[model samples]
Target chain A: MICMNELQLTVDIYALVITTLTLVNAGAVYMIFYEMFKRFYGAKLKFETPVKNMMTLCGMEVTDEVKHLVPVSEIMVFTFRKAFKHITESLTSEFESKVLRDWFFYALIILTALIVLSLIMGWY
Target chain B: MTDLNLGIVLVSEVLIYPGLMFLVATIIFTQWLWRKIAARLGFRRGPMKTGPAGVLQPMADLLKLLSKEEVRTALSSKRLPALIAPLGIGALSTVLLTTPLAPLPIWSPFDSLVVLYLILWATVSIVILALSTPNPYTNIGVGRYLAFIVAAEPPFFISVLVPIILASRYYSDVNYSIYKTSLYSSSLWGLNPLTATLMLLSAFSGFISMMAVMNIKPFDAAEAETEIYWGIFTEFGGPRLALGMFISFAERVVLPLIYTFLFLGGSSPFTFTDNYLASLITTLIKFFVIFSILAIIDTLMPRFRPDQAVRFLIKYALTTAVIALIASITLTFIY
Candidate 1:
């Protein structure tokens, strides 16, 4: 027969474990969502090009005269949209064709189901 | 001794043994060891002329850099951040003092959390220093660094939590809060097979992420010499460069020490004996083993492209971390 303290300890451990797993899952899902959204919608948000900056700093005399010919911001937005479309198309095709990607998604699903079952059953 | 004397002793303990001086010395020695080993592997004699098998090479290099004149470029701005960036290395070394590698673990509530934040702080300081220079190469390097952080941080953070959760399972005494319990405790190890396997996987994932954090090879895209001309560090030279090198070396030493503590049972292997020295020795041995593995990997692997590195971290590392989290939760019920 288990003592009351022993049972309580088990329950506490169980609670902590469940809470932690839930938090991790939620966080991972959020990151996946954020990454996808950013890839598609976050245009005109590119990091500055380092090599060009260094050249200009060194007085090599470089200029984006093309920007004066056409609006630089509009050109950037257009290129970013094209890049985003390309990435999305490639990723979609890869997801459809790749066995390993399918397996990974399946694994994630199984894992999620197990966690939910464990929570509902009060495994402690 | 009075309280004041006691305070002085504690301060000296942090500054001297198993602390700043000790960490700096060990980092220098380890950097030398890494170079020698890499050189031999590549069938070349490395640093043979410097103090007995190039043991003093790092020291000599440091001295040379310190003696050189400081150079500042016209494009560089915000002198303060650039000057203070080297101090971030010192801050990283301080984290070691609080770890189990010390003769005495600097007991604190949430010391683990503190260590995590300190690592981030040190990393961010470097990026800030890079941006202050207004160099294009540095900017690109900083961008790569940010992307690496985003991919690495999640898995690393999640994997670290596994041990914390495992440690919390054994928390019984009222005085021993979840944060107070040492993650290095042996109770966290030698579990049932399933949980043990999961824990090992988590450790492996954490180790990979940490390699990126430490800027080891393959993951060192931010500093790819061939492409970006030394990336974020292109502008730094002389004493500042020495400081940067020392910081990297210190990270190489301290990170493995933390890895041993969190995942390799720390000093627990020697816990059967009452002697603290034995425990410390065992812990040091474990640290060396992990360091050697990292060094070997660094020697053998080629650098990854920044995008590929981020993809690997997210796809592989995150999978392992999720598995570990699920397994840890399952094990909690069984135990």
Candidate 2:
């Protein structure tokens, strides 16, 4: 007969296995559905529709044909890339001007410093 | 006392102190407080006509609802799940007693894991109950709820592990169950910086995830009243609706209580004293603090779209939880 410790270990192992399997299953299902939706509806629902419509509404010029080539499934990725580029451009300009452009930077710096200090002092 | 007498005592304990009676009382108080505070925040007088600034408002509401006849739609299917859905509140209350809310918890080696599963069970019962009605609105709500669950559950599970890992490290014993771990890890946050940071991050992420799990504002896509007409409860009316409301209220109280026990050092504020009453009071205070935080968040934020809610949980909260888990595991090895 297994002791309490052994039983507990077994339970932990079982839990780990179950959690891993569930995550894997969820990921697989999501990917499958995403691919299916993209393959079936990507071309029809491209720019000049929801995304491009929103962009136009926000006064952004949507004259780029290259954006239309990206599938709806990759819209988030494309948006993230554009956002990152914009942020980098802004940061570079701000740093060149030698002025702290955003209050967020100060907050980040202070938070990071506090965390580092806490780490060094062992005062988590 | 003989075995039968002992059995009766155990049953009474489960049904009385820290059990159904206590839980029902707490739920009533918490529901009233939630409404009163929300009203105050919104600059309105809430439940003033009820007993003593709405302290007994929840009780009065419950009585009114129970006095009404139960109603169901003609298209609804499977009366069993709908009838049984409210019983989830009782199941959760029973599970809460297993937590170390008092000086002496109903201790068991694997009780913490049981709590986790029971929570899942409660949520599943809710989904089942929602689906039982077969209404289009409820179907949409269930779809959103399932999506939130898929995104939230992994990080939540991982965050729960952070404390267990830290506690095992603290005790230098790998075999301690979550209940034992939580009991010993009352002072876990005051430990070294790494663990403290990890615990803090985990708790924060866990709290965010709990907001979604408990269907609070911002993450409350499944119950967006404007969009889906109260979502899952669109078809439920009268007594059954009352039960669903009571269940949600209990969930509001119990989820925070669990978190308080797991992370905020349950009863630790009064650990210097040997009095059980002191421990219980301190624990309740901690619970209220957590509850108030949730309340403020609910008041301030707007509801997220289902996709955005899922994305936030997966992209941000899950990442934090994973980082905390890895850090805790690494620290365990180092210590």
Candidate 3:
């Protein structure tokens, strides 16, 4: 680790880059995911719970109308089958919204790198 | 100040008097004041336990929230960037250093630009938190929140910037700094017809923008419980809920405090150089006075649709801001 204080401007620039990226990407994904979420969970399933809320909605009778919904009575089976179906049914899995989970991990990688850089710079 | 002393003063400014501690204290105090005002208006008693006149109620609630489980979702919304929520708070607290209320206020050429950006940091931080989780209600709420911000933030920025321009032109101040502009803003009013009119229009424009940005009533469509399920906070619970609430309460503090400095007069009648304590006290009084006015308006006004609020903000707040800006720039050249 270099003990140089000459890189202070670089550090500020690094901080700005990370903050701006985080804000822009978060906002973009939010709007994008919302549009997709609304379209996928369109009019018929508007009131229906998605598979992501499997555990939260455990034991509740599953909607028979929705395609690929493996209607089951057992709580454990319902949770497991729904979780499996959730993964197979979509490209993004949509833990909340499509890409949000991916975005979360993406942001973390950047943040972790920045944190390490700050640590090396002694920017405590 | 020498380098070591300057370091000490800057550190203290960020951590103590005008920074983190001051921010938390303001949150608790302002929360109490707002609740009490609302309760009074509704003919009911606000929190009167936990501390004298329920002053510590907010703290108590915060502690309770802290004790609860930070609910983990399937996604890493709250977990991955846990720092974002606190970072919002940090960004806001940092802005206090730019005001005359600080014992040793900081100044830099065009620091008002930095202050403007810093306040938005708090705002976007909240947006990040809101976007982390997914719910149908949350999405609509966040959409409304974004709409309101898009409509309100520019005018708010311009309104705050008007004072800086007026001060720079009128006072021939050393630099483009919020502190200098604020100190000069108190006297800018009634100096000349142009200045007086500019201040009046700018003040009204700023007040509306502030209310809308803070999600105070009439413009609170984003955060109103009746309108959407907790708006941006639909997914939060436990400690995350506390952090979300802290962001809201802290916002209510910073926006008004800055408005007090830039528009209403930082600490009139008591110059910070002559008496720091008196000036600080005066600043806080004026700060609450503005907050109380907003709260009273919130109590009386009905919630406006997000589209309606956007239209009003564009039509009224932005128009007035432009008029104020032109007036101030013209006045700057005249005198």
Candidate 4:
């Protein structure tokens, strides 16, 4: 019969977790990012007229006045100002803020634990 | 055990009883129970025609969905990960083998980690299926699901872990096994004051997370039919739709079954180690209670906007879990 010791099982469990989360989160992250790109950068990426959705649902910046101000999709406004602006707006969105807050909260806990462990392991 | 014995165990435990087959049976029955409860609460009749008071309605619905014509939208391509939905079912089934429901349960030290991962995978599988269709409504649904996942999953992971952690401290052999934890979960309440409080907080957080993860009312913005046209399944039809729906239907049974065991002390009045059938009956009774409560809550509550749902889950469920986990870690030091 196949069996594992407690230590081996612990290692196996962590391996299973790390691998699964890496895969699942990578796909979810990509899907969300791709959807955001499609929604926000649709007109600019294709050099087509942007759908400037002025009515913001959930207070998101669906309308891009920057597209109207730019003479061409290749202009510097496209390179620096619009890209950063969109990033800032997206980051500042309520959804993004909540998500970021959760990430920060989790990261703080994990990092604190890891640092304590490191000190214990390396203390002379 | 001999090879023949091992093979029998695998087939009986994993395939026949309390595994894939049992999960299917549970889903069929619970779907009926859910509808019946919801209907009664709403002052309506549920599925009285399917099979002896609508016992087979979920099955009939599945077959009907399977028989429908496959509608492929212009957006749906061969590139989408349609196969993932079944894999979600596979994950759910695999996790069940580690619970007390299985006669010869499959287990290992710290295997609850894998169980938690599988539960998360089931959610991911649905999201990946939704992402296959790149429509505006699908995108919005996917966004809402993402927000909900981010808000709900960690709290659940941490909350569930509190039980396992506390249980491990109580028993040398517990080793974070789901079955082991469930066997002694009720004892956790009587440990001391800190653990009792932690259990209360974690259980509350876990229930809220479970509601969000199941995508029921007040947290189902991802599937808000009026707004997003069935949300993530906007472009899904035919076999794909059936499989997507099957994954969801299976989850309604699977997650609650796990919760009943982990939190409600699986077969508490009767341990499986003593009498398997008695324990199984007790487990079923507990599962029904939890299933009914959740279903009634679902029927009574209205949908929350995606943003509102995420914010509430984070503020309440997530905060409660964090406190619970920190307290659990501290309690370990005390003991």
What i-RMS does each candidate reach, in Å?
A: 16.6, 16.4, 20.9, 14.3
**TM-score, per-candidate, Cα-based:** 0.74, 0.73, 0.74, 0.74
lDDT of 3 by residue, A47-114 (tens): 33354332122245543222322221232233334434544554455554543456534643454454
User: Which regions of candidate 1 deviate over 4 angstroms?
Assistant: A1-91, A96-124, B173-185, B326-335
lDDT, residue B214, model 1: 82
How high is the CA lDDT of each candidate model?
0.61, 0.64, 0.68, 0.70
Q: What DockQ does each prediction reach against the true complex?
A: 0.04, 0.04, 0.02, 0.04
Model 2 residue runs over 4 Å out of place are A1-124, B102-104, B172-174
Q: Among all windows of ten consecutive residues in candidate 1 chain B, which has the lowest summed lDDT? A: B174-183
Candidate 2: tens digits of C-alpha lDDT, residues B1-335:
36465445435544565655677789888877888779889998778777887789888877665555444444456356534554565566656545655322344444457567867866876777776665555666777777777677778877878888888777754344665665666778877666777787788778888888889988887888888777767667545666577667767877788788778888886652366678788889889988887888898898887766876686567877877787667665552
Candidate 1 lands at a TM-score of 0.74
* Models sorted by lDDT, best on top: 4, 3, 2, 1
TM-score of chain A taken by itself, candidate 3 = 0.28
Q: Is candidate 1 or candidate 3 better by TM-score?
A: 1
When superposed on Cα atoms, how far off is each prediction in RMSD?
12.4, 12.9, 17.6, 11.7
Instruction: Give the C-alpha miss distance for residue B272 in model 4, angstroms.
Output: 0.4
DockQ head-to-head 2 vs 3, winner: 2
**Chain B alone, model 2: TM-score?**
0.93
